[model samples]
Target: MNFKNNKILSALLLLTLTYTTGCYKDKSNDGLTPINTVQITDPLTAGTVTVFQGDVLRLKPTLTLSMTEKMDKLEFSWLVYNSNGQISLASPRAVISNQYELNYLIQGEPFILGEPYIVRLAVKDTETGVISYINYKVSIGNKYGTGWLVLEDKAGNGDLSFIFPDSTVEHQIYSSRNTAPLVGPKKLELTPFVITDGISDVGKRLYILAETGSQEYNYLTMVKKFDYGFEFYIAPTIQKPTVMTWLSTTSGSTRSANIGIVINNGKAHSNLVGGFPGTKKWGDIALTPQGTTNYSLAPYAVGGPGVAAMIYDNTSKRFYNIIAFSNTPGAGSLTAFPAIANTPGQFDLNNVGKTMIFQDSSDVVHTYNSVMKGDDNLPYLYRYKTANTSTATPNLSISNIQMNAPGILNYTAAASSTNTGHIYYSNANVISRYEVGSNSIVETYTFPAGENVTAIKYAKYNFNDKEAVKRARLVVGTWNGTEGKLYYFALSQTGSIGSYTKQFTGFGKIVDLAYKY
Candidate 1:
């Protein structure tokens, strides 16, 4: 019994075992029926499906199955999944019809707006006990997509209303959607759509300023995001917001990502809402041009879009400019406009001397216009021209003219035309159109006896709508002591007011109106 005898015996046993295993086979499906493959022919593959809320969603998938497989043998179910391709445990599987088609009303149940909810259909073979799954990414869109936002205040309580493109109004949207009502509305503005480092939201957002506090909301869905304090790393001690505006990187760009300026209690705060990280929060109050001197800034800023904004100082009665504030690179400091020796008596950028009534950019780039009240109790319009860059030098005064129209000093709200030389000002129940070039009132219209003008905004919408419908029109809001009405007046080519085109009633005192794109 040596090593050779042991090796020969092992080889014989291995051969016998291999022969037995190869000859014998399992008979599991030898005479059984084969499971039919469910082929969806319509959608071809799993993909995304888009549907607007409040609309009927119909999905009738075309399937190809074997003749032996009856329609009753296949049971179907629809369930929602998270955007990350995982089943949503918080959502209960809805009992959509067991039939091959799905016709369910999208009451916004289990479907969140702008979220990609994966809708899966489970097809189970009752007889064979086999199941097949097909997934479709479904997203809900808003019905109130593009429109205008109107802020109305009934005494101290504030609420919001949405006006559709066709002038259809849905009132009290803020109260109906949220648990608490908005209080003491001041202004309503929007943050432009921004794409920062390949990450962006579903749509723009609304920045609402009120007496209670400030908050941001989804422009499309009207859902609250966060309060004003969330935007600052170290929130400011005072929360009184006077004015806010989103600055664009270019004058013509629809998207903005450069800067946003907010004035809280005469102090300027800067927030970089888009672009690089570390700039999303609000920086400290901007410093004065001369670090040694303390100045009180006016509650308004003029220019942006890659240029430093011009702000007026009430203490010094002069003009100052500042760019976006950044802590890492040191906070932005206001710089004084350089003195101009060319114009002696006309105007001076460094020493305006007059109190600023209003300041805004004209339709032309680099051209800024301001309404100032002189020491003689008269209002004048002054124009300042500059370049459209961050490093541009302030030019000399373009034009300085005295507004010689009647009741100019008593004007409540003023809006200048973007494409013409017409300036519309409201005083009591009268709206006067004064031509800047002529220095005289061209036309004047008085509203009904008790209607006083509350807000006046020139229609300069950038939306791609009918030119005749949105162009060269003036939006005039009037209050008859108790109720408010919005009037639309079509302007002639010469800037003359024609008959009222349309009007909206059934609103409280309209405080502010902004056209949403």
Candidate 2:
């Protein structure tokens, strides 16, 4: 009876349930947005744009895009290529806006004169990953084709040619330009030197000085400036004199910015600038810096800007402690040079009486170094130890005790610190090197037969690598009568000729190689 009562009491206990709830409303609605299309306006036809080589190429395209999405940013890769679709030059990867403009230096291993090239714009949207390509056919004119410039036909006259660095494209640009008439066309035998304003930007007129390989080879008669038209500027009153450098104006928009072009055939440097009709006292080649009335002597083989500039006059057979730019306001005059001249007969006159000076691109002290041969056609390395004071005189001293490259031509050397560098030279049909350091004396690299070297050089063309080691490669100009080559020996960290990198063969007789920035 107790169990039944307990069960009945439990069952009789009534349970009541209640539910608590709140109504909810949708707070937001959304959907993905997308781009429709992108188009390039302006230059609808991409009319021909004639520009000098090494100049800046500005490409600002008006963009018309039909899209529903907001673009975070636009990425662009502007390239200049050939019909082969192989890229020759590429601009930096740029994160751009609608108003972004494209700027690129028209140089590198490609972009030749008189040839058709394509300027391609590969643009992409950061969000959608959609890319648009726009290409333009370009015909270059009067643009300096880069690489090795050959002065061939030393037999009767001379011819100018070029070879690109990639080792594929070579062209006879000079003749194609038909510039002979402008420079007084004549069958000439010359060992020429082409120099750009070392202190100026690219696109500056290139100066060509043709030296007669005759007596002393010191006679540098004609000074030709390569521009839209071949400008024959300086024909010094004193004929048969070599015009070295114009110590180009430190800065200016006019042509007479230089104090004077160092014009001498083994004589005193004429600092006298400015010319008057029938006036023998006038100076044709400006050696005077702008706004300076005083004369400035030009350096023959001189390099470096800040600490010091290495100076050597092949004609004078002398070098100076400092080139004495000493442009401390009033010092730009003849006093700009040292009172005493140092004639260190370190090089041979047979190299067309040519001298070369180089300093590390990254160094400020300007530890200048040079390489040349003497009467024996052998290469020698010379180092310029910086003087404690700028006023102290300095001359290049032989590095190794007796290190010499045998039967060398177009020999060049580059060094950063003392004895820390390498030298490369052309010997017959082979290439060789002379390593310098506090350690070993010299080392040589001999290429196989038929690798005939005609010229040698190393300049600012690091090619896409601004951080590239300054003298990473020893650039050599070579040819086998019909084919020209721009060969280089890549140097190792220890300054040894590590490997044979790349070379361009085609043109003919790569006589010399120089770089414009």
Candidate 3:
């Protein structure tokens, strides 16, 4: 009996030892494991967020783990610091989370503009108390808004030119009113450049065209201003003694800037092939569609070639150019090329001379084909559909004004088309409106006497000012013989023209205008 009892005790002991060993093995393999490491992948270290003040900014966070572990069990913590050195885990302007991704938004408070803020994100492992963190920087500023003006010194002269929503301001030479002298105007010898309205996804920028001359040669200069100012130039192979008109076209992410100079070959064909001298070379000044790069070049277009003008069609997302040539005539015979086309004869020949080109919202190119003489001669506005270039079509015909009229000599036309209607222009002095549906010049707004009407452009003027609403407003720079004065006019809808309310005037003549932020 004693031997049997001892055997049972030994068997029980063996069973307990086996159970203990198995428990130890299981704990070693799977229990009480420390998190190997934690990593934050996105919102990468020092990533940047660009947003306007008073806007909601969302910050997304991404994370990675040493193991393919589920994120549901993880805990998240976030912190943000302003330039002021204040600390906050939660901001009315921003939100944070512990998920694989974090999102933050700006609050309604008036935060500083053009300032940068800092943010920190962290993910904690609930099981092992492991945490991974990331830091980032963000900038705040205003997005592009309406109701603005731009000015440029195109002539590189000391004169200041400006473009407002309602008016074009041309400072007269030797006028007593010139107040603000542009930077480096006298040194640059900038004179008689071009100004155009530039639009981007975020907003618009004003471009000033000028020429800078060195002791040896001359080059075309392009100046632009937004948050900051930028200037660049292109060199032409040939030299001419006359003034040149700079033309530009933008389509999608592409842009082309060219100059038209009369070719002075001392021959009759010289007038036809190159009436405009110094416009021997074309330059590609392409801009990124997103407004990221200041300026860049894209591909070029090919065709029989002529003069080119561009208009952006928000609805179509394309740019159309009016290409006319000295050798090519007839409506359909003059082909319309997309700014991005990749074919030969899609662009004008190197020396084919053209007068004026314009584009509307429908991607149709309107060209003033008649060549005029002298700085005072103006061209007629003609229409050419993108699909049909064989026959010249009259879109907005002005009958009262004769080509090269005495006072209207050397006049240039500006045009703008919107869903509401179309505005056709002759210099800054006369503006004619046409309802798009009817395509007729329904109304004319002429500047008052002493307004320097010939300096006006439609796209550069402000139409939203209080005075502009009742009557169109224009930026006028006048010369009273002794000094040049800059004025902004608020005209009455219909009546005798009135004196302009001066905005800024002093010593410089207002030559051109541009809008900038």
Higher-scoring candidate on TM-score, 1 or 3: 1
Across residues 1-517, which tens digit of lDDT does each residue of candidate 2 receive? 9999988876665321111111111222234455557787666445765655546667777777776354446777776655543433443333222335766555534665455666677778887788888776666654333444445543334456554445445354454433353232122222223223332222333444344321111111122333211121443444333443443322223323223234344332433222222222213332332333232223243333221333454533334322333435332222223332434443222122333332232222334445544455454455543332344542323232334444434433222332245444445665555545532336665656776666665443356334445345566666666666566655554556555677555545545455432
TM-score per model over all chains: 0.76, 0.48, 0.35
Give lDDT tens digits, candidate 3, residues 171-194: 332112233333422111221223
lDDT of each: 0.71, 0.43, 0.37
List candidate 2 stretches off by more than 4 Å.
1-151, 163-170, 179-203, 211-234, 237-243, 248-260, 268-299, 303-318, 321-365, 370-381, 385-420, 438-442, 465-471
How large is the C-alpha RMSD of every model relative to the true structure? 7.0, 17.0, 16.2
- For candidate 1, the TM-score is 0.76
Runs of candidate 3 exceeding 4 Å displacement:
1-156, 159-207, 213-406, 410-454, 459-472, 489-503
For residues 324-429, what per-residue lDDT tens digits would candidate 1 score against the true structure?
5455443355676666556454477777788877765565665766778888988888887545333444454677888887787777777888767878888999
Clashes of each: 0, 9, 75
Which of candidates 1 and 2 is the stronger one according to lDDT? Answer: 1
Best model number under TM-score: 1
Runs in model 1 lying further than 4 Å from the true structure: 1-50, 53-76, 81-139, 193-203, 272-276, 304-306, 325-331, 344-346, 386-393, 461-470
**What clash pairs does model 1 have?**
none
Q: How accurate is candidate 1 locally (lDDT)?
A: 0.71
